[model samples]
Target: MAMEEKTPVTLGHRSRTLTAEEIEKLSDDKETVSDFKQRKLEEEAKKHWDKFYMRNETRFFKDRHWTTREFEELLGQDFELPSKATGDQPTLLEVGCGVGNMIVPLIEEGSAFRFLACDFSPRAVALLKENPMFSKGSHRAFVCDMTTSQLLEEVPRESVDIVTMIFMLSAISPEKMPTVINNVFSVLRPGGMVLFRDYGLYDQAQLRFKRGHKLRENFYARQDGTRAFYFSEEVVKSLFESAGFQTKENSYVTRSTINRKEGIDVPRIFVQSKFVKPQARYLMQFADGV
Candidate 1:
């Protein structure tokens, strides 16, 4: 079979900085909310996300080749290929794969891999199914909520070779993050790897949260009412290690983007980590060429 060539799409620039009015509104929006009020606000936010994707579908985020560039840098050149297996393509699962932002690029690259993408939002999953870039013959996309559902029931236990969580975890509630991690671990094959990337502590988003927008410590509400939690390296490491995976690479990546008008530089911290599942006895025997 001839491999298909892929052209990378560049996502055009968007300013991360908010205007004065936006910032002021953020500060004033939730000034007197109580804990019960905050929970209500969060429920409303979830509805907003559902409506947002339902209307815009997969176009909410610009289509770009983010997965290949970012995952390669984090895991090295051979990261996308299957290890310890011959004559079989690796199987991958993407949790919170909204509109095939990463999955489309992976398929276009013509790698020897198969994928299963899951998202909690039905709109997102429907959009994924309609995407031309996805091959229904070999790829699967479905709606599954990792925090509360049994991942193994939907995705086979110990069958996935790579799992991706790019910009996905922080969108989940902080209290439910561990449950998501454990669910991901359940579906991952022995010796499989996990690639993760998300917003880090003290990023611009964190500093921009209004006084009453704090849902819990470190979690913030956006103008659209969507909430996100900024993570620290220590918190991420503890979460994964506690879930029985070894952190092979963990680092804080800082990137500076310029405000072309003001000539000011803004730094964003992104925490990236790669974790590996310990091979079960049967898989270790296979790696040893038994």
Candidate 2:
């Protein structure tokens, strides 16, 4: 059998840039320059996100309809998402599972594998729990700040088989990303995998930002207070590699969306990757003995 090292998705779409006026408006910098200097918006990241969830209330990002499609392991009979299949049955922990947008679809499909969905925002967690599909039977949703908070406190140590980080890590400050990865690493069982998806460098969203909204280089804090960071492939690869993960898949995905009424075409670029934690030395030995 061949390993699905890369996602089997088309990778090219022409890039698009927002209009100049749109850039100016987005970069207006709602905070006073003096406040921006003194308060450090990145430090108050949690507050910004909390307020973002409060304002939009689980309605901003659409449910990800592409998850199970991109990752075959999600549906393959061999992996079989969570029933009493055996120790190898895949258990999942969605790192920043906001409002269960991604997990709900899988749960609705009826899986045997257990899932733990967590978000930093209490409101996001609350909203996830509110979903009609949410139940403690196969899914467990909770509030957890992966950057500073200990994942083990809410989850068992090294128990997760798959940790999904979809469109979520970009919200963390680049400086703290290592800490977040290390934290997630601590909770993953040996040989577990982390599936990642996020904005790529020079993506349309990054190109749309103007000066005042810029936080450092590719990082930006939006007028709504929530922030985002565009990633370079090297950076993403390095971050996971530094934390003892073996890179399996690391590539960019590009898709063009057309707006017929507005007569505009938008190109979106995203990075998709998969990294695996090494199995314990003794576990390898035990398997070899068999």
Candidate 3:
């Protein structure tokens, strides 16, 4: 099997710059959530998510069947397991995999890669395991908090071929995000890739937040105690590159989500990108030959 990496094509609804009024509205909220309150929210983050899953189970989110379409890297030629000659199969690790919504679709589509998935919420993991397809598939679903846990303990270092952080990182506090990215960097095989999609700056959800919800610049605490941090392209690039990933595609994807019954049609903004872990040969080279 060839280990050649493919460049992702740029296609999607590109996000537009916010108008002056919009900017003023976002900045209008000068007050931020109190530090003591912020600490309490952070400490109880896991519990809040667990309660969320316990309450909603697998029904809250629709299965992400569109992943293959959005991320062609997961389909066609890229989906094949390495041939018997290579004596190995690729692995995909999905951090913050809630209820197997993403993995279940991939499995149903007959993807050949072995999978390792984790979410801090035990209830989410349990709900995932309850899925008959997931239970019978080539995968492992466990409880893990990426901010503090070590992926190498679950799998060998530099062994994973792909890592997907779909809408996962935004859920974390911005200050601790570097730790999570560094941890992802450690487990990926050289030249392995990360597929990411998260809320983008000035998204509807962010704009909907009133002054009291602001935790910090671009970060907010929701009424449910769950938190979200909207991203700018610069921040996403900086985070991955600082952790040794080569950015392939980093851009804002925009869309209009409509609910005619409620007379709601709002633009949704998301940051989606692909980052590759540098190959070992490149890592070993310096300005002067060794």
Candidate 4:
């Protein structure tokens, strides 16, 4: 049987200018940035992604399929849309939104939502800006390192109604995970929602890591050397709750795929979650300093 052709998706938006601090930090990280050995590995991975888009640039998934089909069903609920019902459009932020995979499709669906997308890679952001599907009026894209930068500085606080983190959070190191989560929380309005999906424990991709590829703990190196961390259900809850979100839905999804070459079947696990911030407020107590 012939292999099914993989269709590439077009998801593009405009790129934002990096701040001076971001430029300086990127420049000073010479070991990671300029080291010939590491640079070669990084370049190889980047080249792979570039080639992936070059070949499959026009295809896009029509909806937030993973979240809609998995988490929404498990929780027996639906997204609580804004109540104002105004002519003004709702705003959405897609962190680690690669090439507009989710954002572009949402826009094309004719929903009255504006989107802002961010990825740490300059190459990804550049391709997003160049794509004809990127509409400046309704969408914006930027190269942002969420772990170190201030999200509110670029995007106004309490301005976004929905934030999507599809298959993106597992890519960051565990230490930096809090920073990314907090940044997302700071920008979301009270009663806003966050939709998340990422790899779960023992997925084929996790088990495939070789010995030396272990970066730290559960984190593993991909073929292109980009790092990924798998999350347990408890860990996912802690990460979001610690950032002041209330987990409305959390569950593990198991799916099987045929391994034709091995003449067998394989199973994959994905953790899907929907978390919301409560409408109630907590009082802050300040201590006096001498």
Candidate 5:
């Protein structure tokens, strides 16, 4: 079957889904990394990410200024405590906060929520703490391996009001995803929420992998030694729902990434979703379609 090609329209424009033939072709490579190598990749995931931040510093990823534009729930009143309230400021924890790409922007945007950010890479955490904004607000940056460590040690259980997993969870091995999800769930308040975005199945990055890059089904070890697992909407829904989160929103988010200098334009697929940790007796519903 001939793969139907899509022409780029405009940056950030919605993109069409890949046909089955395209998906099959992209994943057809039979060769995969050896089990011994796969184990090494898993064991050194942190070291690779640390080296990544060490080399790239704060320059690799752009500031995620578009976060509020895409997930407006960040600015919702739920996270903004009443001016007169005596309680501690509402807390938002960012898991896998690399160099504060998401943290710095939200702070700059005049957000009122307190921030608690953690990353597996110690170097990334150090860089984030060095950012001028880190000391200016109610923000804390720390090093944590959520897959193997308990977030409760760093913060009180159910103390967080929101957790953002932007472009971060894909780096972990699939077997540990549940552990990470449960860690996030443990720290969230009863009515808290998780705002998630990560690479999706058939994303251009996924299709670009060649033979031997496949660590396992839908998972790959990049040349940098950092791993990524492309997600499906069903996988997103199932992982969170099974961890006791109620799904509020879960779907594929598509856009075209273009490079005019190289005359290259390609569709990028990402899964963006919202899942809520329900209150014992009630589940909060937003009128704005959170």
Candidate 6:
């Protein structure tokens, strides 16, 4: 008898139901940690990220290739940056921008736009500045901890045209996720948008965590001391909405990568969304008259 060849599913396009065992293991009921401990860990968020950058420098994650493809808004079609009387352009702030992976490509590919990219890790910001693509005219790199810091102080309130939180918010504790969302909301212009993508709940990497590494609910600490959180589409939507954002697109993207030599498959899931700070009611009314 001959074995039948199976068709392969491309990564991030296929989704599967969680097994009973997986559901049971991923349940939050089993998690038991004191609020004090959780708070302590959350406070140390910056220390861990700083250490990660000090250790990996610019080699940790590969530059993301999917930002523009997934976000046509980044292409500058919906709204054009008014040609500046002084050559100034619309602004974008990339929270948790590590080593300029996503923004570098955006700068290299898109029309000229001002950028304010920051991270909790000073080393990451340093590396980003060192990149040949980094420019003082269009890009500025800073260090900020989204959990406790404020974006309004750094970027003018209601001035930023877009905030890209790509895989960055999950590093924040669930307790501070609201603060992060609110900060994004504050910096964005009345009609500005947030382009977001982060690990989705039940992704293979989440299920692959070793026993005892789980920190709380969907959050986990890796062997390197850096932490991550998996998110559900609904949870993310609520977070942004609660912060006064109007959700435009919210959905999960699942892809699988098969390793033939190892006879293994890895499924990656991401929740990608577009949310806008509602144009101020006055602006809405005025636009209606226009």
Scored by TM-score, the top model is 3
TM-score of candidate 2 on Cα atoms, chains taken together? 0.80
Over 27-131, each residue of candidate 6 has an lDDT whose tens digit, in order, gives 634554566756666777677778888888888888887777888878877654333223547788899999999988887775467779998888899899998
lDDT of 5 by residue, 115-205 (tens): 9999999999999988998877768988999987567799888888889999888998888999999999888888788999999877889
Best-first order by lDDT: 3, 5, 6, 2, 1, 4
lDDT of 4 by residue, 174-239 (tens): 877999999998888788888888887656566656545665555666765566788778889999
lDDT of 2 by residue, 114-217 (tens): 88998988888888888878865657888887877568789877778788999999988788899999988888887778889999866777766665776676
Tell me each candidate's TM-score. 0.79, 0.80, 0.88, 0.73, 0.87, 0.84
Query: Relative to the unseen true structure, what is the C-alpha lDDT of residue 29 in candidate 6, on a scale of 0 to 100?
Result: 41
Clashing pairs in model 2, backbone N/Cα/C closer than 3 A? 81-113, 82-112, 82-113, 83-112, 83-113
**Residues 1-290, model 1: lDDT tens digits:** 99998864332113244455655555455544577867776566547667779878766687657667767722336654444465465788889888888888767777556789998777888888898879544899988878776577788787888999988898887888999999988888778889998998766667666576677766877776677888878899999988989898877777887999999887787788999887753323355555
TM-score of 3: 0.88
Compared with the true structure, what per-residue lDDT tens digits does model 3 show for residues 209-259? 877999999899888899999998999999999888999999998889998
Give lDDT: candidate 2, residue 131. 82
Clashes of each: 0, 5, 0, 4, 0, 7
Q: Which regions of candidate 1 deviate over 4 angstroms?
A: 1-33, 41-46, 73-76, 79-87, 261-263, 281-290
* lDDT of candidate 5 at residue 125, scale 0 to 100: 95
Q: Please tell me which model should have the higher lDDT, number 2 or number 4.
A: 2
RMSD of 1: 13.4
Backbone clash total for model 3 is 0
Better of 3 and 4 by lDDT: 3
Write down the TM-score for model 1: 0.79
Q: Pull out the clashing pairs in model 5.
A: none
Q: Compared to the true structure, candidate 5 yields what TM-score? A: 0.87
lDDT of 4: 0.69
1 or 3, greater by TM-score: 3
Between candidates 1 and 4, name the one with more favorable lDDT.
Answer: 1
